[model samples]
Target: MDERFTIRAMKKEDIEEVYEIEKMSFTAPWSKESLYYELEQNLFAKYLVVEYEGSVIGYCGLWVIMDDAQITNIAVHPDFRGRKIGEALLRFSMQLCKEMSAKRLSLEVRVSNHIAQSLYRKLGFETGGIRKNYYTDNYEDAKVMWVNLG
Candidate 1:
């Protein structure tokens, strides 16, 4: 971990950096408009960004619904991969979910993303189900994963 890096709640000013990371991390990244809407209008949405010496390097978003927290997205900058930033982001999100009184945390990852699936498994996420053709851009299947906090 870089001593200069810190994790904190995402701000409206971080949209550009977040967008850049999203573009680098995912084939079909969320639009800036969607990110803006989450920051401005979504009460259930909670986002966190990792800043390395004041620059946003990674970000993750979660949506709290009832007693569950759904991990909407998570991405690390291409330059910062293999540095454990993603794990830190996931840990922070899990802590936030617990603090928000969520009994479980859930997310959907592309079936082809074995690396992410391995990471989630190491973090205690278990496969719940599969969504056929969940990702439209490439028609990739999605594997649903869940972690019980209770």
Candidate 2:
């Protein structure tokens, strides 16, 4: 956290950098075209990026539908891992969702991703349920988690 970073909504010009981080962080990353569509076409989408020294280092995206928000992705560049950038990005995004009038936020994490699950729990997210075979890449079960902003 010693490094200074600014979190802001993702812009069209920031797509490439964000996509690169996405690729580095996910076993099954979203395509650049899909990311572009989320920003340009998905009305419910709210994407944010963390910038350090004028470069994108982390990003998170969510879809707020009515009073509920569902996180689609949260990731930090591989070089920036273990710095709590992911936590900061998710916290900032949750605040943004609250400002947008979202009463709750939720996300799905791989059952084996204990690190992410621990972080979510630290942020007050609780295990809600499980989605069997949620990750198409490996037929991995996903642990559903939720937090009420109120």
Candidate 3:
């Protein structure tokens, strides 16, 4: 939890490290192709990586469309969890969303992920709705959350 840890826009070279963290952090993680598509094709997508001491420990992606920003994904390495890295990443993403003139930010979290729910709530996000059987790997429901920025 060093205060010197930095977050910056993700580079193509950082995808491997990001991918590793994605795999480690989620049970049904995004495929490499899906991530590459976001990096190479999504024009409105902004991806970021968190680095501490030159090592990538976490990543987040946002897709901005009009006045809304959709959080595509966020993950932190297991070893780096509980150190506030996720909170830092979320705050950074919120700032980026505001800079983009987004009126709101939205994301979906597994309903069972209480830890993430609490973190998002602390950041001013509220549960908006639920998507039934949203997670493909295990058919878990997703709790859609949103934060009003305006």
Candidate 4:
């Protein structure tokens, strides 16, 4: 398979596909209604989707406020995981934040998600702290990670 992945700003119509990937990738997925709200109502949010052959295969959610930015969520379809799509999405998101003049970018990962944590560290993120019981589904502590964009 020729994996020609393209990343672009997500549109309202991409919600259903994005929601599917979201549900498959996370233990507690965001509701489609919440995605609608993110696209239609959230002022601090920006979303980007990765398209492969006209299908939405992955997505990233970003929230920028002042000079700080947060990765609200990010995921790639299981069928597309080994291609480093998630890393690409994170790189793109970091560039977007830099373009927006954000001095720092941060996100939380489940402590058990070492693959993701490895990717974050490769992108220069460092562990900042731990959030207790961050994942409601399993009550797993979240490892807070951050990187300096400046």
Candidate 5:
């Protein structure tokens, strides 16, 4: 397979492209203002962008607090789906957390996102709990997943 994608630290300039994928991937996408806030003001936030031929195709965000890390969000462009781009991005995030001395990582996924859940499981994440009505858009439940990196 062609792993032509390049992953790098996200920048303020990447927001427009990231927002495009965000809207395409989520029912209720994060606002540009919110993304900007995270990139500029959120001290705990760290984001990575996946680029293909110089275009931002995927991205993931993580927050390392003390010995724990939390995945904020991850998404890929629809055109780039099924190419393992999301998986690559996630694996990269896991490494970043480890480098930051995080002992574990966790994230919440929509209960209906079986594909994502499967990927999480393949990466050694275990279902820890469920957050009821986690999605404000449709009141969908979210499954919380965790992995011990320690």
Candidate 6:
């Protein structure tokens, strides 16, 4: 990671920029209200933002309950793709889950998103199952992947 890049807990003020990244990266982007609820009302949710040159460039959302943690969302600004920022963010999330005593980490990715699946596999995640018609936008199937943190 470059000195100019830093990852920290997402603040309420970051919702706007983080939402922009979400819109650019996903077909069904999460609303600002949903983001707000995640930060303010969701007891199990933890969100993190990655900043570059003092600008928000990416964010990741995790939900840890008991011994399990799920990556609720993750995205990088389109302009920052291919720079390994997403990888760094995911690695940090995994460490955070471990610190929270989560024994496993999981996420669902669009089955067609080979790039993301490759990255998850590189981080030791394996395909667990598939959810048919999981995506509302195009009715795409979702590939569930998980890795044990223990």
Q: Which candidate is the best by lDDT?
A: 6
- Across 7-102, the per-residue lDDT of candidate 3 in tens digits comes to 999988888899999988888888888888899899999999999889999999999998999999998999889999999999999999999999
lDDT (Cα, tens digit) per residue for candidate 4, span 38-123: 98899999999999999999999999999999999999999999888888899999999999999999999999999999999999
Candidate 6's displacement at residue 43, Å, is 0.4
Give the number of the best model, judged by TM-score.
Answer: 6
Query: Per-residue lDDT for 105 in model 5?
Result: 100
Q: What lDDT score goes with residue 7 in model 1?
A: 90
The TM-scores, one per candidate, come to 0.98, 0.97, 0.97, 0.97, 0.97, 0.99
Q: Identify the superior model by TM-score, candidate 3 or candidate 5.
A: 5
Comparing 1 with 4 on TM-score, the higher-scoring candidate is: 1
Question: If both were scored by TM-score, which would come out higher, candidate 4 or candidate 6?
Answer: 6
What lDDT would each prediction earn against the true structure?
0.94, 0.93, 0.93, 0.94, 0.94, 0.97
Q: Write the per-residue lDDT of candidate 2 for residues 31-55, one digit (tens) a residue.
A: 9999999999999998999999999
Residue lDDT tens for model 5, 1-150: 256778999999999999999999999999999999999999999999999998999999899998999999999999989988889889999999999999999999999999999999999999999999999999999999999996
Worst 10 residues of 5 by lDDT: 1-10
- The TM-score between candidate 2 and the true structure equals 0.97
lDDT of 3: 0.93
For every candidate, C-alpha RMSD to the true structure in Å: 0.8, 1.0, 1.0, 1.4, 1.0, 0.5
Per-residue lDDT of 49 in model 3 = 90
Model 2 spans > 4 angstroms off: none
TM-score of 1: 0.98
Over 4 Å off, model 5: 1-3
Q: Which ten residues in a row have the lowest lDDT in candidate 3?
A: 1-10
